[model samples]
Target: MVDKPVPDATRRSEKSRRAIHDAALALVAEVGYPKTTVEAIAARAGVGKQTIYRWWPSKADVLLEAFLDLGAQTARELGQEPYVIPDTGDLAVDLKAVLRATVDELLDPRFEAPARALAAEGLVNEPLGREFVAKLLEPQLRLYVDRLRSAQDAGDVRPDVDPRIALELFVSPLAQRWLQHTGPISYEYTDTLVDYALHGLAPR
Candidate 1:
């Protein structure tokens, strides 16, 4: 059987949701997360506060969804279908490609400011931090997990190596630099990370 068309009201609601997401990202980028309130998002989005509340309980919730949408948009912009990691049997190549894309995302001006602000907030606010990690970070990390597991199955990665731990060798360093300004973020830097993570820091 064929599916029916979406209702006009549903289409309008979706359009409003997109507007809200765009507004949330813009507000957070402009004003920081703490000052970005529901009323402000409503006004910027051209919707009522009740419209936002009908879909999300709070500003944090709206921002979270907005950030998730941003990730997908960024992925598409980078020529990646969101939430997927390539599993070419060559683990090094696959890892480098993903890391390079991540470096691009981290370096993007549109993403950097708001992400940094939210990250700083997450650092001091334990509950919010946990929510952010659980809602956004972990799911993204799991894509690496699945990719590494594929590599292990292909004998491209050591059987004894744990995918989750192995992934952090590349991911955490990039994350630290991006989140804390510990160092510069670049394609070459992430490429080196993929090498070091896969080939061991010592000899060989």
Candidate 2:
């Protein structure tokens, strides 16, 4: 009898990794991060625990990477280029467009549950929180910083303004509202935020 062709190792490994990521994300979303475990993820993934151990040191790391993958995957599904802040040369228009997209992402049910779980855990878990910020959140924020710097170069933003701090004006309020459920989130709400942030409260 002819020997069967061997499966491609790289393709097999990638499929397993995607399975592991999905399992980890779903488990955390269902049970919360504190209760999610490597064994649980591995079992859910249909892979051995040793398979997980081979790639990640801990559950936190797995979840972090899983979340990152989820973002990229979700962006692809939405037809967006992940991690990009578009520069249309009109600062207000650019910022508003991005914030509107953010509103849509924050409200997406598939992303919301797992993202909230991880974000909640990051608040009290200092090391995980720091790592989360450093690895995931900060990089996205830096895109805003870069865009603000470019706006400054065009004299759209004041040269003396700090791009980092200026971004917080629009970004932080929406984050607070989302995380705390303080108010509704919508394109309109976010558009208003961009307006107020860019133009200020006093009569324009």
lDDT of each: 0.88, 0.89
Lowest-lDDT window of 10 residues in candidate 1?
Answer: 82-91
lDDT of 1 by residue, 134-158 (tens): 9989999999999988888888889
Q: How many residue pairs clash in each candidate?
A: 0, 0
Q: Give the TM-score of candidate 2.
A: 0.93
Candidate 2 residue-wise lDDT, 50-124, digit = tens: 999999999988988998898888788878785678888898899988888889889988788988898899899
When summed lDDT is taken over every stretch of 10 residues in candidate 2, the lowest stretch is 77-86
Clashing pairs for predicted structure model 1, backbone only = none
User: What lDDT score is found at residue 168 in candidate 1?
Assistant: 89
Error of 1 at 177 (Å): 1.2
